[model samples]
Target chain A: MAYKCYKLESILTINNLTKKFGYLTAVKDLSFTIKKGNVYGILGPNGSGKSTTLGVVLNVVNKTSGDFHWFDGKISTHDALKKVGAIIERPNFYPYMSGYQNLKLVCKIKGVNYSKIEEKLKIVGLLERKDSKFKTFSLGMKQRLAIASALLNDPEILILDEPTNGLDPQGIHQIREIIKQIAAKGTTILLASHLLDEVEKVCTHVVVLRKGKKLYSGRVDEMISSNGFFELKCNNQEALVTLLERHNSFSKIKVENDLVTAFLTEPMRSDDFNKYLFEKGIILTHLIQRKESLEEQFLQLTDNQTNQI
Target chain B: MLRLLNIEYYKLKYNKASRVLIIIYFALLSLMSLFATIKFNIGPIKFHLAELGIFNFPYIWHFNTFVASLLKFFLLLVIVSMVANEYSNKTIKQNLIDGLSKKEFILSKFYCVIALSLISTFFVFVVSLILGFIYSSYTELTIVFSDLEFLIAFFVKLLGFFSFGLFLGMLIKRSAFAVAAMVVLFLIEIISYGIVCGINKGTELADRIYQFLPFKSLWNLIDEPGSRLSAVKEVAAQIGEDLSYDYSVRWYEIAIVLAWTALFIFLSYRLLKKRDL
Candidate 1:
């Protein structure tokens, strides 16, 4: 498939968006911007307003306050939505109708040509069962059909909420592959998920939300690579801890399960540390430098945010 | 508008409940006409016209209109199911997400109501025409087409009732509850009319005001046929005298039904706009 080249421009801008259900605030004053051709992930724990934010932007749920503009104010919400495809919360369709019929209905509503229906069904690996009723589809097949429906219009932007919520491992892999392929075609994809690994694997950019408040938003690589740490296990654990505690080169050294881990206080290489340990007569067995995983960063960020409150 | 109607037609085309309900409605409608053609005798008296008046020229319009209006329940059931299924299946939310405006969604349903009404009315018109030709004494076009106002009246009455059913479905958002609410509303309107009539006693103004109620206004569209058997006419006349209100179709009654239809459409639109899917 040929990829479309889109200009580097802001695709969506939301400012101080808040949604309140009576006394309970589902989404606080939230704001974010999505750029063209980037797979942006709204990452959060359950009930962190990930789905609500997507719903508000999609115009399915009315915002209580605040506003959002699509395409940097070039078009109204309705017009902007025409270029976007979305599936909010669940894959809802007419259960009694065949998948082909359901996609045809979507095409009718979106005013898109029905010619792409067969192609989309083939892309999702559901072309074989396209004639089957939605009620008879497995959960994985249902989710696949939903992606097909979203792709029916060849939308410039795709919004998905928990697209792989209840799928088995094989189902999850298929969905992830489909999403990557779509994103590879230069379509800006905005997806919400509570799965940390999914965001780390699929998202180029991420916004970490906790309890309807944004804790951090930036590139995923930048978030994970900011704090680099080293894990080391020596033949003598006591000597390794003492040596690291005395040296000013390393900070926050801690011993766990016969392994000493610490952050680099300054720019240094693992080779220098190994040489230092060899010089001190401390025979080394294992020394590895590792970047922080998104799960750890997410937990630390959310815990810190809670402690500040 | 045509596109929206086409979309609704596609949705209904595959719906089993809609298909079965429509089939049952037509079957029952045919049976009602069949019953109107049968003849029976009670000892020394005859009761064939009770079964034969529906086929007579000119009077056939009034007779068929009354019978068709009684089958409005089928239309109501179809409308309620169509509207309520959107909510239960969460398809309404999907429709909105697919870029359909709230107004378009409501208008699509109104189109469905109109289509259903028109189709059923056409059936009644065709059946009446066939029966009138086969059994009436006169063959002149004027004699067969006289009192055609009842046909128009019947169409409007179906539109009014079906639109009202759509409103109730929107309000209730549940098929079973909405249908039950329709029955309850009918009973409430009838009871309220009775209470008002009883309190006013012999006041003509109060009796006139009672005819303007939602369901009652629709009922007043086609007045009871006055050319029934003498015994039946006597009983109807006695009841009419006690109520102190005429069952004649009035111009304002048709106007009232049109107004109610507009009101229901407006309320349905308002409800869809204000409420989150």
Candidate 2:
């Protein structure tokens, strides 16, 4: 797919922000910028201040120190917020009210005229159940309604926390489609979730945190090396292990039962080794290059709990 | 402000607790009215303690009576239920995060409470007017035109109770606490009145406290021969002839109620705005 780059202007900027809850610091001096039209993902473990950071940025929770600016051609938050919509926590709707009525409430608060409620319902694909009481919605449908409510203002930005909390695979696919649809319309998205796989798919850039501090923040593909690694499968694993042990050309060597893995110092080095093994009458079943996954990058950056804030 | 009011109005119209309260209120009022009609044989009797039940209902059968006697208690229930529902359901924290300003959200609640109270009071007044006509066999008994003096007194009493209920909800955002405080307020006043009359021979400090308490002041709005001031006088005379209980509604009490409401709202708003959602 051909990529269309946004102008790359900063839409959200945070500097030296902190939030303290009595004895514990919820967010510890975090700083980062989210550029316009970028799908920025915030990744963190449980209680790692992901929610706290969002709460402070959205002005729902007061920060103990530091400042943030929404530089999308607006001065104050009310103006900026007029162009922004958010769902900071779980889906909230009056249980007695129908899904449409709940969205109407959000519309009133957001001060946006939404004559076509069905359009939003269509966007989330909940049009058939718009009349259902909010309490009757499954967690996934409730989340869709929450997203629909945030979309009411036709906002330029959407801030969501754990947007797909409880969902089956199909529901997750549905939500992913809806998010991509919104993004296709040029709405910048700021999403927080512990699901690295989801972030890897939807986000352009990501920020990872551990114990209230920023561990890593950059372009997603760059964060995970796009370069390849060798994946070798062999019949004579003992002979291959002996050969690898004699040569110190790699790091992170591991032998698990019948399989052994060793990182290569150069690409195609595995091909030369395979040829030598073949000459020795050792059959190689599988030999392919493997790219790093987001999970691996996450574990690498946040290696230990002690290193966390 | 108007937008906030609209939101509150919409929520109340759709809230289940509000709906249940309305249904229960009319059910109780009809049973009381039916019992009174059968006992008096007047179809719409003017004044019968048997029909009157607990709260004061003088020579009237308007909406105010239905509201004063039935809906007032139900209104308190609404406030308690509304706050409690938020906590029990874990929605208050969610609403705050959804972009409602702290002041706007709290004000929406108070707005709903006041609107419901006024609506209930008006509904009672209207029902009484209708009953007045039905009993007299005259279709044209105009709605009673209350004078400024009566209306002011009624407003003061109504606002005092309304504010008290609001304070209770704020202090105990949890449903159980809110409901308990409301029940206690009502029970303490009812029990104190009985104790002063029967046990203490009307000479105890409890009698004096009962006379000045906010809940008891609600009776002052009724057009009775024994003014609440007189009730205060009865208690004050117990100590000395020169002093009376000061039964008349005082501005200071209104100030105190307003202050209490403000304090509760401020504290709750602070917690809402500062705490993690």
Candidate 3:
């Protein structure tokens, strides 16, 4: 899908937000900005303040300190919320009511036209079962109905906290597809999930959180690209290590059990490294360039934070 | 406010418990009305409650208020369950997430309480009017409208009591617990009243202060009629004349009920605003 550039606008801005439950701090002084049309992901493990942050911003949980603005302060919090749809923690609805009835109630609360209910239900692939009671639905179906309710307002921004949680592979795939489709329609999304793979698959930008603190925030590709590494193996491992040590392009080299791993300091083709090593009489048996996965980066970041503390 | 009311109405209509509660309320109300209209003979005297000035134009107001007040427990149970179920189901959180302000959410329930009170009072008015026309001996318009204040008293008492129920529901956040707490609260108040009376040695000043208690204030809205039994008619007449305070709704009692209603609503709102859903 082609990206639409609507003049860069701040969709949501949270500053110095903190939430405390008695002496336990669920969300520390945290802040982030989400621009329009960006699929901003709050990536963290469970109890890492992802849901609490979403709750505070959505005005469902009162903040202990600081403030947040939605739609660039064009409206009050309640008024701004009308233009936003969200599902935090889990799919919560009137269980006794049918999917259609639940969505109707959402529309009523949102003060939106009911014409879009069917369209949203269709988008979530729940149109056929719209008449089924919420309690009768499978967890996946319940999650789909939640997404449908979130889309009923045709909101400008959607905030989903663990949207794909408790879903099977197929259910996760369907939810991700639905989210991508919604994003393509120019709806900014703020997703919170502990699943690093889900965040990597769906988010354009991510904010890594640990113990209620932000560890990193930037574009997903940049985060992975900056930490790219290469793994190499050869028949003469000792000679290969000595040769790579002489090269300034490779940094942080480590050799373990005939395997060599090192980060590339600058963008260089693997074929050039192979040729350079071949000139040194070291035959290149294997040369593999590996881009860091979000999971690895998340672990490293959180681990480093833990070590520092 | 209207939008909130509409939303609450939709919610209540879809809830089976609420529907059942309303049905039960009406059924019990009709049964009590029937019981009142039946005639019975005791010893040498043959007397029916309906004929003992109860269905008479002026006294119909008191009779209806007393009967309707007996059914207020059903409304209280419904309100308690409705409020507590929101917490149990986490639908209140969804409602807030769906763009409703905390104030709006509480106000919606408040609107439901008012609606219930008004509906209950309307039924009382209609039933009493019908029974009064059929059983009343007097035909004057003035007599028919003599004690209309009792209707206002009934409405106030229902609103006050239901708001208290709302408060209990919000405070407990569990249907069964809130209902149980309400029953316990009644026992506590009654027992406390007894203790206070004993301590004060049944002085008039103590009795006057006791009437101002929250539950006592609401119950005092409609005084029990004294002319029901022929045996006690003369003594009842003497007591009624001596007290002069026992038969009519007082301005202070209305103020007290209204005050308690406001306090309950305020506390419920504060609880919603301050708590994390």
**Single-chain TM-score of chain A, each candidate:** 0.94, 0.88, 0.94
Candidate 2: segments with Cα more than 4 A from true spot: A1-7, A72-82, A226-228, A233-249, A265-285, A304-309, B23-71, B121-147, B185-249
TM-score, candidate 3, is 0.94
lDDT of 3 at A165: 86
Model 1: per-residue lDDT, tens digit, A1-309?
234444577889999999987798988999999998889999999999988888787777789999999987877676677778898877899988999999999999989999999999999999999999999999999999999999998887899899999999999999999998998898999989988888788789999998888888889888875456889988898888888889997778978998888887676788987898899989888889876789988887899888999
Candidate 3 stretches with Cα past 4 Å from truth are: A1-6, A255-258, B41-47, B226-231, B235-245
Winner by DockQ: 3
Give the worst 10-residue stretch by lDDT in candidate 1 chain A: A1-10
- The complex in candidate 2 yields a DockQ of 0.32
Instruction: Write down the worst ten-residue block by lDDT for model 2 chain B.
Output: B50-59
- Candidate 2 residue lDDT tens string, B57-105: 2234322342354346666677767766766666665555455666777
Which pairs, if any, clash in model 3? none
Candidate 3's displacement at residue B264, Å, is 0.7
Please provide the root mean square deviation of candidate 3 (C-alpha atoms, Å).
Answer: 2.5
Q: What is the lDDT of every predicted structure here?
A: 0.86, 0.70, 0.86
Interface RMSD of each: 1.2, 2.6, 0.8
lDDT of 3 by residue, B1-277 (tens): 8999999988888888889999999877666568465787889879787666667787778877887798898888889988999998899988988889988988999999999999888888888887778888885888888888999999999999999999999999998899889788889988888888788788466668867778888988888765443435657676774433457888888999999999999999999889987
